[model samples]
Target: MKLFVFDLDFTIWNAGGTWCDSTHPPFAWKEGKLKDQENRWIYLYPEVKEILSELKAEGHMIAIASRTNAPTIAKQLLHMFEIDHFFDAREIYPGSKLTHFDRIMKELKVAKNDIVFFDDEYRNVEDIRSIGIESVLVTNGLTKDLVKPYLTRTIARDLPQSEAC
Candidate 1:
């Protein structure tokens, strides 16, 4: 079994507030610095929930690695979408997701090589890769056709089935 991590912001939903865009949620702005906001999910992608279910059944532990101030937002979004059951943990409002990834890996006693991550941002993907985790970049909108190439065992891992794939 392997752990599958994901970044929330641009990877999942394009929430109205984005640190990358220099737009902060009304509650996040304070003294020229951005604070964290609460209670919101930008959007839920079609089949995202289903894909998660398939992964779960395939014995993968799903996790969310997001940079947000309010961790509650992550919980709320998961609960709202009925996707909470799939995640082993919801990391919200973290200063650095790479740090969280390290903690999670250590706590779970899994090697970084066993982790698969999905991120929309190139920087975040690169950061996770630095720690030995493999990450797939989520496109503007995720589709089976787009994701098919990487579903093969070759790019994702060196499983025995790579030849068949």
Candidate 2:
């Protein structure tokens, strides 16, 4: 089976320039702290969720490799947007995504050639490619219009049966 991995911050949603924007130690909320945390949500690009749903139907396993440290972000994603339920794994840290990717592939026993990764940063994409993994860069992040071609390619290559539909 193919493994699809994506970067969380800018690639998935615009968090105002950094992945830790919604958390403490960087920018703490002054009111309803816990509730505020619960209220916060990153807007998902329109096609992203639909494409992911389609990928799931094709037997592709999804995972996330990001630079987030707090586990609450994951919990919030599960409770608020239900995103956590979509991914088989959510790996987060401050360093390279390669670390997370390595772990996920290892744990899942997926080969590098069977995986594709997405990120907005060229550095991240290049690094991932260095490890012999295919990757795409989201120049405009995840706007619906901006990412259609990429979704098309993914659909064509991963789920060819859905290509005509």
Candidate 3:
């Protein structure tokens, strides 16, 4: 199965144009909203859960490759959303996208060609592509339709050269 990696922050949850403060305690999930210590609300994009669920159900390995400084809070948020269990690997920390993917590939034992990444940043898309991984830029956040073409293309590309025709 292919490994699918994702970014957090704007890519998963809407942080309201702000980075999650590493100093704040973990967020609290209540009545479908995640609130910080100061009661600032953060929400997962509406389509994230459904897309992730479908990918997991299809036997693809899901993972997180966030550059959030607040790694602890990121983990808490994932668990709060109840989607943490879907991830088979996670590389959450403050670092370059290259470092994040390097660790993720090593931990998962997957090659660059076998992985697909989704991020909301253009620079990240470029970085991932430089390493031979297929990446999708999630401008308005992830949706099933946005991901389908990449999956189809990757599957076809991985086919034997003779069979690709």
Candidate 4:
């Protein structure tokens, strides 16, 4: 099975250039908005929920790999948004993307080649790709068009070149 892993902050939601810091406290779902202690709103980008739902409906396993320092706030936001159940595995914390992928791969018992990772950061994308996993740099966040190609290309790319012909 193909495993889809995504980064949290910029990739999943718009944290407004400032992540949840100690003073910000955990996020709360209030009046249909996700707000921190200081009432800063965080919102999911366009098509994020639909794309993730589509992936899940297609039987792809979803997971998270975030470098956010405020994991509690991240998890709370995920829960508040009601999309946390879509993920089968998660490695959310402040660390290298490689470490996150390594742990995810082990937990899921999936090979590196069977995983597709998405992150807004180029450095994270490059770092994850260096370990043999297919990685996409999501500059504009997750969208159906961006993720569709990977979903369709999964089987063909995993096949031996000679046999794929």
Top TM-score hit: 4
Pick by lDDT: 2 or 4, better one = 4
Q: lDDT by residue for model 3 over 80-106, one digit each (tens)? A: 778888889889888788998888888
C-alpha lDDT values of all predictions: 0.65, 0.68, 0.81, 0.82
Put down candidate 4 lDDT per residue, 94-137, tens digits, no spaces. 97988888888889898887889889899999998888889998
TM-scores for all candidates: the values are: 0.70, 0.72, 0.84, 0.85
Off by over 4 Å in 2: 16-18, 22-41, 69-71, 143-165
Residue by residue across 113-162, what tens digits does model 2's lDDT show? 88888888899999999999988888766554443344435546666575
Error of 1 at 84 (Å): 0.8
- For model 1, how does the per-residue alpha-carbon lDDT over 1-165 read when each residue is reduced to its tens digit? 778777776666555455323323443334543243553325556667666766676677778888766566555555645677887866676677788787777767778777788888787878887877787888774444444343433245655565545
Sorting all predicted structures by TM-score, with the top scorer first, yields 4, 3, 2, 1
Model 3: lDDT of residue 87: 89
- Displacement of residue 82 (Cα, Å) in model 4 is 0.7
Model 1, runs deviating above 4 Å: 16-41, 145-165
Instruction: Select the stronger candidate by lDDT from 1 and 2.
Output: 2
Error of 4 at 40 (Å): 1.4
lDDT of 3 at 30: 69
